[model samples]
Target: MSLKRSLNRALAATTGLQVRKAPRPSAPPPPPAAPVYHEPAAEDRLLRRPVFVISSIRSGSTLLRMMLDTHSRLRAPHELHISRLEVGYGSSVSEYAMQNLGLERGDLEHLLWDRVLHRELVRSGKDFIVEKTPGNVFCHERIRDSWPDARFLVLLRHPESIARSWHESDPAKRPYEKAVTDVLRHVEAVDRARETLDDACTVRYEDITADPGRELRRLCRFLGLDYEPGMVDYGRKGDPELKRGLGDWRANIRTGTVQPGRALPGSGEVHPALLPYCDSWGYTS
Candidate 1:
């Protein structure tokens, strides 16, 4: 999400409001359990079993990260675009092309990204590390390549809210198309990953803000951690270091509490073009 959009959300979200969504007649009871994780070999470094918080920008993934960071067993650090560095070799004439270079460049990228995660884990001395960067959702395979045991935590927010936040963040293009397209792409990316990985867990942004403890406790079990009381007190005990590193994305969480968030006002009707995404993802119109 853009800086302006981040600020707009910050200004508007003083307190969260539930939209009172209608009950899901077809929805199953107990919801779905997150993927079960088998213990890895003792030799496998805890750093290798990284956890990823994946979603599009402005979908509350950052807030989720901050909350998880407060956990004793977990550390949610700054964005490490590990996958972005793994530019697979392909035939192209562009300067960033990896085709001409042998496996050298790709190997280097893997090495650097791996080491970064390793260092972060070592510094925090935590059992696991969760990296949050919205764009990470698009590079599931790349992440898998580096750490076969890496786990994913996927988050979804209403497309209406996503599009509005995206457009508000960027002024150069000044239209909603790009925002809508990005949201759709992210939605598809997350769905594919859930289908492919047993270590993946999915959650909704609305659910998180609606009852943070419930959603987070579910996430905790998914990641195989015991829930700590006050895990949801992220708003009150925010991380200053994290806030500074986040740039404009820093505004709201700095409010020293998790402000109750609802669908953006007047966003009851999702845009027509974005309806396909809503239907597929279970977002009400």
Candidate 2:
């Protein structure tokens, strides 16, 4: 018999009907909690400062590196062969060595790769420091582990032309045969690495040579840099640091032949096995 009940009883008496309490309105559902969003901190957004290039020998990797070096934002180092040395073997090793290394190959590879990359990056001052090593194709994981935020530029060329060029060059003097085999092996390695890299790019040598401006623009876009026309003319500008051996193939090999043979000696035509890769990269048939 509280006041409210008394009032209700009074109301019931006056209205000739029983007074019943209204079921408590369901307490309005508690307001939904505000969504909390976490924005990445400044450190999180820093561009992964990789200055590394992985490409097969005779694949225009040198030219690509030189062109990239022309950019003020990048410093392309000469062929360091860091990965090759770390792997404890040269690319010229016979197939037997590959078998003998067996399970330990991966572990030894990881050790050598980690040491060289960490040392170089720790010592480098440039924002984008690149190691233009041909053997890196085989050591992408080691590179990726050391520099999780790193970027990779994989260069490719026609294997037939690569093999022919190697065969024609003095084997004893230049080790061209080994270079050819290495190029093929590295191509496959890069292809495998493509699957795991988050910020990786692939460029074809022919496409870069045929239309440097276009290719360079695309490359810059990939690297999140502003493209400059001067990158194409790096060689002509006499940049002393930029190596001159990039386009030597054009002068050294004859045109219209893919492989070395009696029919077409020294002619540097696109290799058939490599044609699909080149074509995929927008090379002319």
Candidate 3:
């Protein structure tokens, strides 16, 4: 008998059990990863090195937008929400035509976004443009692909404060619990951007509100623009008034003065759902 069979038979006869082979150890699961995107050829796009602000709702991005908008060389328009813009083929024949032309739905949408922003920059007579749409945090990589030379500013705020402000923005429609869930999406997205986008700049709402001029100077350095005094006193320059859908319309923003941000929420007061993000952003400690 084969030695293996003899051993198995002996074990079965002696102990009423066969020599059972151990199952192989499973390979460790791969680490969690984010999607990777590549930019299209240079000829495919119009805009270059445009700045985008990646932030959560109610993170004081509107206030920063107003400041940047006042810069002579830079234009910071209201929330463009351009990433949500999508393209669709009208028919299968059209889709086939586009496929043959080497254009996909995403590629077409990227072209549209680039052209739209380029038109805005041309109209404003500015050398550079900055867009501050909060939802862009979720699609930083896609934006990078669209404008291979895109710059980003990752805006952050205390997680609890963001959720509270969102709820209070429309209390009747957005209850506290729902607000936490909704805002958590943004908070997590911001964290992801911070973790992944090493080239992006990061600033806190509290820091911006605490010292407007200083923060504006820092931002100017990042954007490669001279710090214009007009950007510091944006209110006096007759900026576009705060429209409801475009950005913060609260009396504070309308007042055109940088107001101090609310105190950070105590650890005990933070929602459990937001704790992990809070920790990730260094808000808890």
Per-candidate Cα lDDT values, in order, are: 0.71, 0.60, 0.85
Clashes of each: 5, 4, 0
- Report the lDDT tens digits of candidate 3 across residue range 142-190: 8887887989999998899999999999999999999999998988888
Tens-digit lDDT track of model 2 for 26-85: 877887442222322334333346667766666666667667877877777567666555
**TM-score of each model, paired residue for residue:** 0.71, 0.55, 0.82
- Tell how far residue 56 is off in model 3, in angstroms: 0.6
TM-score of 1: 0.71
lDDT of 1 by residue, 206-238 (tens): 888888899989998988899986778865544
In what order do the candidates fall by TM-score, top score first?
A: 3, 1, 2
TM-score, cand. 2: 0.55
Q: Tell me the lDDT of candidate 2.
A: 0.60
Q: What is the lDDT of residue 57 in candidate 2?
A: 62
The best candidate by TM-score is 3
Better of 1 and 3 by TM-score: 3
